[model samples]
Target chain A: MEQPVVTTKDALLHAAGALFAVHGIEGTSIRAIAKESGANIAAVNYHFGSKENLYLAVIRHVLEKTRCHRSEELLKHRRDWEGKPLLCSEAVYRIVEEYIQQFFTGIHPRWYGRIFMRIFLQPTPILWEIINELVMPNFDSLREVLQCCRPGMGKEEADLWLDSFIGELMHYVFAEDFLLIIPGHRKLSDAGYQKDILRHVAKMLIRGLELPVPVFLQEDIVHA
Target chain B: MEQPVVTTKDALLHAAGALFAVHGIEGTSIRAIAKESGANIAAVNYHFGSKENLYLAVIRHVLEKTRCHRSEELLKHRRDWEGKPLLCSEAVYRIVEEYIQQFFTGIHPRWYGRIFMRIFLQPTPILWEIINELVMPNFDSLREVLQCCRPGMGKEEADLWLDSFIGELMHYVFAEDFLLIIPGHRKLSDAGYQKDILRHVAKMLIRGLELPVPVFLQEDIVHA
Candidate 1:
């Protein structure tokens, strides 16, 4: 195996992602990224080639960290890494919890997802392909985990489940503005309860994944 | 009889709202607002008192339109405009759809919310107060609708359901910049597909509302 890469490129990406998150892709520049990373401007040019590629590299870096964190969390709880796994609901629970704690409000506190949203909504053919292929596949693990939770549902139903799974994940990641909401309803502070957003979210997912009461009485009697 | 005041402030707000939707709050100005509305700069100052106030007024104006539209949609489906109730599910659907459409290329658009999110992740107390009173109530309507759909779940479960509901709403709304995954995913060339979005969304929402197999087994007797 390649002895892996040096942390120079990694540090550049880290500095670049924070700057980009705060100022956005257009607002942040190569000069600033070079200055912040303590790397020579030529080094940036040498590695990423341009500011645009640097931005793309920065995004991939953060995504890889996120993916690895969740993957490790899921695998550690399970006995094996690759197998036909019966996913613990707790596995889903931890992914969400760790995602909230480690990523959303983590060191790179600012989120540039709105910028991503802005570009994607323009439906730029390039962005569309990334979302359809790269991002959506991130949730395939969730779909597999969710499958064990709801076996009777059809493929269409399973697809819909993935939609909600990804949808909730999307909103939580991008809609950090609403983080105050947990407290806004007095659901957090004056309500005399400790904040347990992860628990609430996990329980809600379970409810949504489970089946509803049957519409027909005759069918209900035999089924029940 | 107390007639509604036709103050310069109201005119400034009205004019600002339309302009901001097109040019964005940052893109629009007091001078243009005065020019278009046939009001002078001092007239804008007299009403909005400041540019920021004018911008906020624009936001409030669009949000008010959203609320009014929802009221009308639900009322149209109701016998008594005041007493007629929209099903919680329908209400959630309406709020989510309307809110998404409000930003996703619609009759009334305000880039303020998107811009505002960047500025105010940790919003001022006033903004939080306003959102709690306005947006949170809309969210509760969604919660109630899901509750009506799945009455057996506990409150904790419902919290997760709301999380997913908000996610779906935000996903489609913010999907403009989805290129991170879909490399070349761009906007649909055809505007007609926007309706098709609503159909897929409606289907997705229904799936989120459905329970899993354990719950399904509990209701298998039902034809649905």
Candidate 2:
């Protein structure tokens, strides 16, 4: 039988990434990562040189995997709907369904998701760098899909609607603690439940997009 | 003019609340709170008995204020629309608009908001306690309003739709970091923009409730 080999560096990266995801970078210690990985402190120092470098590398590694996986999904969606122009509602539905998959059941490790959420909650300078390289391409892809759904939708308008959709999707995933506490609410363990919720969310987004922009009230103007 | 006197306990709670909002409970230190509040370590000990107690107290204090303020607004809404039947759209719009205001521009201090978001992201045992004592009452109120909007809606169905609306609102506030990065996206500082977004979200939610549940596809069944 062939034995799979795990590099000391890979082990350290995985451990560090998990820790950093649960506990923000400032909250985690190098010693904890070393202990969790079963790597000596010297080995960690030799591999990553510095904690900051290791943190950045871990983010890069996780994001690289996410970007590649999501890009493929986007392509798959395009192929599935090829030659036929999807209706506005269909396009939005597909886009949201894809997002729901990514947010709840994507290939990224559970802890890896924590790192992404942490950055959003408590942003570091590195977030901008990640956004530019990793996030923007994916966001642009979604934006393009949305534009196809609603032709002539301005980027600014799309941005707001897109944010609303993404926000709600993220909340479903991120606010599980709060959600679980609500009377009669269940944990999203069943894949069937996830799909149903996603469809519901997609419908909401489509409806939201169709609503008229309200005329600004004087109070709103004064506040603005 | 009479000057109000603040107790040592109040000082500690105020400082601790701010720090905990910015940093998670695990990330914050007793010494930091003591220093920030200008109350010595001895005073902190004398007042709260322990760090855990102090932390709980701070959360309780913030939540107590939030509950009172939010309850008043909800009552005001009920009173304003008294004797007149509110359209489903109007009820949803009012509910969502109120949420946006409380989230982005509510009476609770900015830092207090952080503690709530943190609980959602990184849950602790205290969250269950808070949810039962503080959050449930408010959520029930929303559910009541929603039931009025869609008369005879089942509790289970209402829970799902309500989650969609709350999830979207929470996302807008929590995902500001990501939103700021999106090209053409602007800060949600304008009251006019806030109202428009609230109306948009409410419309989507109302539409979503009216949407027929999609038939499960073969692929979805397999995947589920």
Candidate 3:
């Protein structure tokens, strides 16, 4: 029997993603990646053709994996909801709860957050490409769910609400270090804290969607 | 007349802040700082004593500056609210609005966001120090405002709401690049968009605070 072998492409992508996360694209060297992956410079060249291509491939791989995981989560919730349609607030809670679970699961590879943060903070042309191909379609699908829950909601208002919802979760997922550092404070590290955050945020977002327009925001919303 | 001179300490800090933002603390070197600042290596050693010390000093300087600016804003709002004590929802709106203004002001030094992002996402012992000395006090003060707004709100609940509020602002301030890249969607770069976001989040958070507790979260609140 022959031993299993990892493909050169996968090896290069794994090594590149980790290195890129730490050193960034400009700071990382092809020679270093080749050495780290236990592949020769020739193999790296043959597989990726160039450093830029390798970086893009790594992003694509991560995006695809993330999409699959998230889509499954979304679809599962939708399927459950279909059996007995959830009230608007209940649906909102469930959706946000799933997001919190996914965010805090720590299942992603170590370098995934770094790579995601880099692109999010300092976007380039490649970011536009990724958002168009990977992010927006999924976003639209989620937006539809939220909109269905509140038929009276306008699209712009709904979009803004969704952005806020996702934004809050992003901070928890990406900036937990900042949140956790405050001494003597309640840490999100406590058991069930993530669930609490989910409950709080979902209630807030759903209420926000349903609340009568405050007079101050009326002018702003009109223009918006 | 004698020409005014920039001190070696100021030069080193400015250079180090920029370099650290791009390459992170470990990746930057004293040699690079010296060269960039036009100060000799001996001057760098004499002023900061070590690279780590200099890094800590830079964080302290930034935190102090940011704290001062934010404190002024909060104080101004409080004074105005004193003359006409704002309603809970109105106060929430104003506080959030001020935050959005500060976040998008672009008045902070160029490297501020990058350096802040690095320390925030990837923590070091220095992060703990910075959070203790600079972050927690300001956070506690803001938490008080939120607590005052909703008299019935518990400490845990207020803290959760505050986190969600700040988290939404962080996305706008830090992740604007990602926001702007979505094709055919409204970009934060559009005029008055930040204002709209401030309004949206303030409304959502206020409404969420006032909304009746969902059944699932009721148990968590009791335990909380």
Candidate 4:
């Protein structure tokens, strides 16, 4: 089958995202992006108005693409759980599992992660917008889920635990290459290894929070 | 007393480290380093031979400086523990605490961390050498300490757990800036906050590994 034609705007964003991932914002030039995308400099200006706008567009494009996929999966999950009552612990496990799988496996072209790491290391002005608009709602949902798991858990304490949980997962995401150097470490690309990580993280969170284990995870806890 | 004079090579390494942290390896130029360090381009060539060599020298300088301080602290801890049977749990706690503090606070000028992060994200050919020479020794020590904590734990399991532990700590180190945007988050620079993080990490690891809590940490576990 013939491939659909890629618009100049999409091509520019893709090219800019890859270059920015490697050289960073200030390091990457409009001319380089234009050349990489096979578009003229004037075309870049016409499409995105400026390099900064183009950078923001690239970030938005990646985030929106991921967010759309996540929303669909989450919608499916909600539909599946509609008639069945999920224990809070089970709910948290599923949430974390879905998050890990989607984050590590669902994102594509690799540059998406690099772009995120670049912005994470050196945040731009749009960071506040991205956090509030795209990140905060998900964080709020996770926080609410944790509170449901352990009633009377103080907001501050719950937030800290959530941070620890996220720190563990983000570390693996960001440092996969570094982690692989350790003896006997498995590839994140391995589906079984991903499940192992999910169980490992869930075990740590459930135990650390002193929450009652769901029946599904009880066996793993014993062996762990 | 008059301030000590900085040598030409030291100046170049310092400048290169800072610039590389901002612009990355390929993005930075030798002329920029020379200008920033107030040395001529010829002087840079005379001192470090090449930009790549200068970059490696910067890495070596930062690692050695931190290692020296770490060695001193470890020596002091050993001396203090002499003739007293230290619990494996306590040893692990102390090692992790020292690591977090040294990694986050002991390194000076801030640019050191930025340089490390840059290298971490965009690894150079020297990464393997660094893994073997600097990182592996510390990792080995942690692994041994963990094994002492939990006898009969498989090497692969122990390694996975160690990665999770390191992942938690590293996430805090790497994502400190992004994390601060979260509501109710504390500054990493705060000494008290660092202790809270240390305790939080220890609690998670101890529970996750099912290790017996040392007498000193028993109270915290109860409250936790």
* Interface DockQ per candidate: 0.27, 0.34, 0.35, 0.45
lDDT tens per residue, model 3, A90-145: 66666676666555645566576567676775677766777678777777776766
Off by over 4 Å in 4: A1-5, A26-43, A68-86, A220-224, B1-5, B26-32, B68-86, B218-224
Which prediction has the highest DockQ against the true structure? 4
Which lDDT tens digits does candidate 3 get at residues B1-224?
11233888888898999898776676687899999999998877799888888988888777776562343355456645533333545666666766665555555665665666776756777568777777777777777777665666666766787788778777776676666665445665454565567656766666665633223222211100
Best candidate according to lDDT: 4
Candidate 4 local lDDT, residue A78: 53
Q: Which ten residues in a row have the lowest lDDT in candidate 2 chain A?
A: A215-224
In candidate 3, position B105 carries an lDDT of 52
Give me the TM-scores for chain A across all models, comma-separated: 0.62, 0.77, 0.72, 0.79
- Which digits, one per residue and each the tens of the lDDT, describe model 2 over residues A1-224? 11242999988898899898777776788899989999987777799998888888888876776552343365456756433343445656656666666656645566766666776777667667876888777777676666655657776656666777667777776776567767667666556567667656665666555532222211111100
Q: Order candidates by lDDT, high to low.
A: 4, 3, 2, 1
What lDDT does each candidate get?
A: 0.52, 0.66, 0.66, 0.69
Which DockQ-derived CAPRI band holds candidate 2? Answer: acceptable
Clashing pairs in 2: none
User: Share of real interface contacts recovered by each model?
Assistant: 0.45, 0.72, 0.71, 0.54
- Give candidate 3's iRMS in Å, 1 decimal: 5.8
Which of the CAPRI classes, incorrect, acceptable, medium or high, describes model 3?
acceptable
Q: Using TM-score, rank the candidates from best to worst.
A: 4, 2, 3, 1
Candidate 2 RMSD to the correct structure: 9.9
The true-versus-predicted C-alpha distance at residue A106 of model 2, in Å, is 6.2
